[model samples]
Target: MTPEGKALSNIVILGFGFMLMFTAFQTCGNIEQTVIKSLNNFTASGYTSMSIIYGVFSASNLVAPSVVAVVGPQLSMFFSGLLYSAYIAMFIQPRVWSFYTASVLVGFGAAVLWTAQGNVLAINSTDTTIGRNSGIFWALLQFSLFFGNLYIYLAWQGHDHISEKDRQTVFISLTVISLIGCFLFFLIRKPDPSEPTPSETSEAPLHTESTDSASVSGPPRRSLCTQALDAFVKACKLSVTKEMMLLCLPIMYTGLELTFYSGVYGTCIGAMTRFGHNAKGLIGISGILIGVGEILGGGVFGILNNNRLGRNPVVLLGLLIHYLAFYLIFLNIAPDAPQAPEEGTDLQAYMTPNVGVALFCSFLLGLGDSCFNTQLLSIIGFLYKEDSAPAFAVFKFIQSIMAAIAFSYSNVLQLPWQLLLLVVTGFMGTLSFFMAEWGVVAKRRDSDYDSI
Candidate 1:
C-alpha cells in the first residue's frame, strides 16, 4: 500500500479498535448496574452479589496488562470479546452459579479490553498528541456507556407493568449488544507502524543517552526469568520517580472516590428497596446522572486541557466540586424525625432520605469525576512518552485492586452508614489535589533534565 493509504488504514483501525474498547468498557458498566436490578427482580441479595462481581473484576484488572503483553493486544481483545459474549449468554439463565461465573468472565474480559486498548493507543500516538487522543478516546468510551445505559433503561421501560418474560427479553437484548461488538472487532487492524512493538520498547531508557547507557551496561542479561524480573524491577524504579509517584496518588484517590460512590449508590438503592421504596426509579435516575456526568466531565476536561488552563487548577476545582457533592449526600442521609402516626411502619419516610441523597450525590459525583479523570490523563501524558501504556495500565490495575477491596468490605460489613464512605472519599480527593499539584512540578523538573 502507499504511505498515505497505510496511514489512513492505521487511523481507521485505531478508531475501530477504540470503538471496540469503548463498547466493552461501557458494556461492563451496564452489566454491573443491570445485575443489581436483575437480582432485585429475582428477590436475591443485590449488594452482596454486585459487590462480589465488582471485587473479582477489579482484581482481574491487576493482571490483565501482563496478560496482554504476553499474548499480543489483538488476540487479547478478541478473546475478551468472546468471553464477554459467553458471560452475557450465561446471564440469561439467572442461576446463582450462572451469575457468579458470568461475573468472573465479565471481569476478566473487561480487564483484557482495558489493557489491550491502552496498549493500542500508546503504540499509535506521539507524545504531543497522546493527551488529545487519550481525551477523545476516553470521552468516546464514556459516550458508549451513556448510550448503553440508555438502551437498557429503554429496554426495561414500564417494568412495573411488564411480565417476567418481558424482563427476560430486556436482558437478552442488552446481551446482544456485546455480540454485535464482537463482530465489530474483526474490522480493527493491528497496531500502527509508528508505534513500537511491546518487546522492542518495553522500558524507557534511564536517560537521554540510551545508546551509551546500553553500550556501557552491555547486552541485556539472558533468560526469560531474568528479563521478566529485570522488567518488573525497572517498572518499580520508574514508578517511584517523584513525578510518577505523585501522579499515582491522585489516580489512586480517583479510584477510591469513584469506587466508594459506586458502592454507596448501590447500597442506598438496596436500603431504599428494603424499605419498600421506588427502587427501580432511583436506580434509573442514578444511571442517568452517571451517564450525564461522564459525558459532561469528559467534554469539559477535553476543552480545558487543550486550552491554556493548566491541568492542576482544573483538577483542584473538580475535587472541590466533588467534595461539596459528598457533603450534600451526607445531609440527605441524616435521619428526619418520624412524621405519620404509623411512622415506624412507614416505608416512604425511610426511603425518602436514601433516594433524595442518592440523586444529588450522583449528579455532583458524575460531574466532578469527569473533570478529575480528564486532568489525570493529561498529567500522565505530560510526564511520560507515548509508551505510557504499560504505566497507565499498571496504574489502572492498582486502582482496581483498591476498588475491589473497598467493594468487598462494603459487601461484608453491609454498612448502614453508607454516607460515611463519602467522607473518606472527600478526604482522599483533597489529598489527590495536592499530589497532582506536586506531580506537575516534578514533571517539569524531569522535562528539564530531558532537555539537557
Candidate 2:
C-alpha cells in the first residue's frame, strides 16, 4: 500500500477488525449470560461465575503487554479472538466448573485484545482526530450490541427457553464470526516503521528514567515471565503519580460499571422482569438500548472534539449523567418486582409497563459510560502516545480488579450498597479528572501543555 493508502487502510482495518470481534464477542457473551441464568445458578445468583471471568481477565492482562510485544499486534489479536471463541463454546454445556473455566479463558483473550487494540489505535490515529476516532470506534463496537441483541430478541422472542438446535446454531455462528475477525486482522498491515512510538515521542510523560545512558542498550535477555513482572512493578511505581493515580481511579470505576452491566445489572433485570427467555432475551434488548446511548453520546463528543471543548468538562458532565442514570435505575426500576397476577393477567404484560423507563435508564447508562470513557481513552492515548501499551495495561489491570470486586459482591450486596458504588465511585471518578492536568492538543503538543 502507498503511504496514504496504508494509513487509510489502517483505519479501515481497525474498524473492520473491531466490528467482527465486537459482533461475535457481545453476542456470545450475552448468550453465555442467558444460558447461565437459565441453568439456575443457585451459587450467588451466578455472580460468582461472572466474577471469575473478570478475575481471570485481570490476571491475563499481566502478560498481555508481553504477548503483544512478542507476537505483534495482528497475531495477538488473532489469538485473542480465538480464545474468545473457545470461551463461547462453553455456553453449549453450561456447568459450574465449565462456566467458571470459560470465564477465566475469556479474561485471557480480553487482556490481549484490549491491550493491542488501544495501542494500534493510538499509533494509527493523530492527536487531532483521536477524540473523534475514539468516539467512532466506540460507536462501531457498541453497534454490535444492537445487532447481537436484536438477534437474541428474534431467536428467543416470546419464549423463556431456547431449543437445543437453536442454541447449537447460534454458538456456531458466533465462532464463525470470530474466525472472520481473525482473518481481517491478519489483513491489517504492520505499523509503519517510520512512525515514532510514544516512548520515542517527547509528548509522552516520563515512564522509566534512564539510570545510565549507555548501560542498557538492547532488549533484555529475560523470559516473558520476567518481563511481565518487571512491567508490573514499573506500573505499580508509576501508578503512584498524581496523574496516573487520578486517571486510574476513574478508569477503575469504568471497570466497576462494566462489571455491573455485564453481570449485576442483567441479573437484576432478570429478577425484575418475568418475561421471555428467563429475562435473558430482555437483557439483550437492554444491550441495544445501551448501544443507542453510546452512539448518540459518541456522535456528540466526536462533534465537539476534546481539544476545543476541553476534555475535563465533557468528562465531568458524563460522570454526572452516569450517576443520575444509575440513581434512576435504583429508584424507579430495579427494586419493583412484577406485580402479582390478577384474574387472567397477561403473562407477557408482567413489568412491561416499567420497561420503557428501564430502557431509558439503559440508554443513559450507555451515554454516560460512553461520554467519559471515550474522553478518557482519547486523552490517555493522546497524552501517553507511544507509551500507550503499558499505560493502558496498568489502566486495564486496575479496572479489572475493581470490576471483579464489584461482580463478586453483586449478589451478596444490598441495593443500597450497590447504589453506594455508583454514588461514591462516580464522585471519586469525576474528582480524578480535576486532579489530572492532561495536555489536550489538536495536533502537536501545545506550548501551554509543556507543563504536563
Candidate 3:
C-alpha cells in the first residue's frame, strides 16, 4: 500500500479500536459499581477496590513500556480485555483471594492497554490534530459509561433489594460484553514503521510530535532490558520537571475522585434510601446522570478542539464545574434527602425532591472529569510526545498509587472527613492547571497552520 494509504488505514483502525476497548472498560466499571451495591457490603468491595487498583492501576505501570514494546498495542489491548474479564468474572463469588488475584491481573492489563492506546493514537496523529484525536477518543470511550449506566438504570429500575440471581444476571452479561473487546482488539493492525516520518514503530514509544522524536527503524532492535531501562531513565528526567510534577497533582486528584465516585458515592446513594440507608441495590439513576454529563462534556470539548484560547480556559472551567459538584455532594448528603425507599422495590423514591440537585451534581462531576482528563491527555501527549510512553507511565503510576490510598482509607471516612478530602483535592486540581503550560498544543497547532 502507498504510505498515505497505510497512514489513513491506521487512523481508521485506531479510531475504531479506541471505541471498542473503552466500551468494555467502561461497562465493567459500571458493573463493578452495581455489584458493590448488590452485595451491600463495603468491606468486600473495599478489598476488591484496593487490590484491583493495585493490580490494574499501580503494579502494571511499573513495566508498561517494556510490555507495550514487546507485545505491540493490538496485543496489549487484547490482553487487557482478558484481565478485565477475569475481574468481572470474579464478581460471581468474590472471595478475598479471588478478588485480589483478579485485581492484580486487571491492573497489569489496564496499564498496558492505556499505554499502548495512548502511544498508538498520539504517535500516528500530527501535532495539529492531537487535541482533536484525543478528544474523539475520549468521546467514544465515554459512551460506554452511558450504555453501562443505562443498563444499570434499566435492570435495577424496580428492584427493591437485589437478589443473588440479579447479581449473577448483571455480571454474566457484563463479562460477555468484556469478552467482545478481546475479539475487537484482534482486528487492529499495528501502524507500519517503515516510513521516515515521526510516527512510532510497534516496538517504540510514540514520537509523532515530540521534542525528542526518534525513528525506531533506522537501527537494529535493542534488547528488552536495555529498552526498558532507557525508557525509565527518560521518564525519570521528565518526572522532575516542574510542569510534570505540578500536573501530576491533578492526575492524582483524579485518582481520588475516581475512588470516591466508584466506591463511596454509590454507598452514599444507597444511604439516602429509607431501607437501612446504605442498603444493597443499584444506584443506577445516579450513575446514568454521571454518564450523561460525561458525554455532554466530551462532545463540547471535541467541538472546541480547534479553539485558540489554549487549554487553560477549558481546564479552569473544569475546575469550577468539579468544585461545584463537590460542594453540592457535601450539602445534600442528609438522611432524609431521597425520602427513603417506598414499600415496593421501585427506585423512583430516591429520585425525589432533594436528590435531583445531587444527581445534577453528579452530572457536573462527570462533565468536570471529562474536561480535566481529556485536556490532561492532550497536554501530556503534546509536551512529551517523543517520551509519551514514559510520560503516561509515570502519570498512571502516580494516579494508581493515590487511588490505592484513597480506596484503602475510604471506608473509615465519615461525611465530614470525606468533604474535607474533596475540598483539598479540588483546590489541588485547580492549582495544577496554573502550574501546567497552558494552550501548548493549541499554539503549536496555530503555528503549523500558519506555516501551511
Candidate 4:
C-alpha cells in the first residue's frame, strides 16, 4: 500500500479503537460519582477518586514521553488499555481500597495512553493533512458519547437510583467492550521512518548526531531509566518555551472544562430533584446531547477547518459558546447544585430548573470543548512536528494538573462558583491563544522574508 494509505489506515484503526474503549470508560465515568456514591457510604468518594486519577495522571505525564519512546506507541497504548480495563472492572465490587488503587494505576496508564496517541497521530500526519486526520479521529472517538450514553439512558431510565446489582451488570458489560477495543491496538501499523516529513531536512542532522553519539561504543546504550530521565527533562524544557508558555492557559483551560462536562455537570443533573425522580436518568440524556455537540464540533473544526478559518477564531467561538452555556447554567440550575441535591437544599437560581435548558447547555459545552481540543491538537502537531512526543507530553502535563485541581474542588465548589472560575479562565485562555497564534505568524513571516 502507499504510505499515505497506510497512514490513513492507522488513523482509522486508532479512532475506532478509541471510540470503543472510551465509549465504555466514559459511560462508566459519567455515572461514577453517582453510582459509587450510591453503593458506598461516602458521598464524596466519587469525586475524590477522580481527583486521584487526574493527580496521578499529571505526574505520570512527566515520564510518559520516555515510556512512549522506549516501548513505541502501539505497545504503550495496548498496555495502558489494560490499566483502563482494570479500573473499569473494579466497579463490579466497588471497594474503597480497590477502587482508589485502580484509580492511581489508571492515572499512570492514562498518561502513557494519551501521550502515545498523540505521538502516533503526529507521526502519521503532515502539516497539510494533520487537521483533517485529527478531525476524522476525533469525530469517530466522540461517537462513543452517542452509543454508550444511549445505552445508559435506556437501561437506566425511570430509575430513581442505581442499585448494586444494576451497577455490577453495567460494569461487566462495559469491561468486555473495553477489552475488545484494547485488542484492536495490535492491528495498528507504525509509520515508516523512511516517509518524508515537512521538517525532515532540517531535523536530519539532529537525528544523525544522536545516532553517531550512541554508536561511539564508549558508553552502553542508554538504559530505559536514563532515556526516560532525558525525555522528562526535554519535556520540562519544552513547557517553558515562549510559544508553549503562551499556549499554557488555553491548554489548562481544556483540562478544567473537560472535568466539568465529563463528571461534574452530569452529577448536577443527577442530583436535581426538580427534574423528578427520573432526574438521575437524565444524566444519560445530557451525555447524549453533549456527544452530539462534540461530534458536530469535531467535524467542523477538525475536518472542515483544515485550511480555511484560522484556529484563533474557532477558539474565540468556543469561548463565546461556553460563556453562553455558563450563563444559562447559572440561571437555570441551583447555585448549590454541585454540592447537594434539590431535596438536600432549598436553593434555586434565577429561574426554575428546566430539563430542556439543562440539556441544551450540555450540548453547548460539548461543542465548545471540541473546538478547543481539535485546534490545540492541530496547533501542537504543526509547531512541534519533530519533537511530537515530548511536546505532547508537556501539553498533557499542564492539562492534567489543571484537571486534577478542578476535580479536587468539584465537590467542594458550588455550581455558581465553578461557573465563575470557568468564565474567568476562558477569557484568559482565549487571549493567550491569540497571542500564541500571532507569534507563530510573525515568526513564519520573518523566516519567509529571510529566505528571499
Q: Which stretches of candidate 2 lie over 4 Å from their true place?
A: 1-5, 40-45, 194-234, 273-280, 334-353, 438-446, 449-452
- What does candidate 2's lDDT look like per residue over 240-292, in tens digits? 75567778778878888887665555445544543333355576777788778
Q: Considering only N, C-alpha and C atoms within 3 Å, which residue pairs clash in candidate 1?
A: none
For residues 72-131, could you state the per-residue lDDT of candidate 3 as single tens digits? 566667778788888888877777678767777777777887777777666665566667
RMSD of each: 7.2, 6.1, 5.6, 3.7
lDDT tens string, model 1, 1-452?
64334423543454455454444444444335335444434544333554555566566655564555444565666778777666556555666667677677766776677666665555444544555655665565555545555554565443433345654665566566666666654554433335443322443221112123323543344532443344344445556777666566666666666665554453344334333434443445565677577767766676667665567676777777777875665555422111111111223333345556666677777777777777766666555543454566556665666566555555444333434554565466557656666656676679899999
Q: In candidate 1, where is summed lDDT lowest over 10 consecutive residues?
A: 336-345
Question: Residue 170: error of model 2 in Å?
Answer: 2.5
Candidate that scores best on TM-score: 4
Off by over 4 Å in 1: 1-62, 155-163, 189-239, 260-279, 333-360, 412-416, 442-452
Q: Model 3, residue 46: what's the lDDT?
A: 46
TM-score computed on alpha carbons, candidate 4: 0.93
User: Could you give the candidate ranking by TM-score, starting with the highest?
Assistant: 4, 2, 3, 1
Which rank order by lDDT, best down to worst?
4, 2, 3, 1
- Quantify all predictions' global Cα lDDT against the true fold: 0.55, 0.65, 0.65, 0.83
In candidate 4, stretches whose alpha carbon ends up further than 4 angstroms from where it belongs are 40-44, 199-226, 341-346
- In candidate 3, the residue pairs with backbone N, CA or C atoms under 3 Å apart (3 or more residues apart, or in different chains) clash, namely 55-107, 56-106, 56-107, 271-277, 274-340, 274-341
The per-residue C-alpha lDDT of model 2 at residue 441 equals: 34
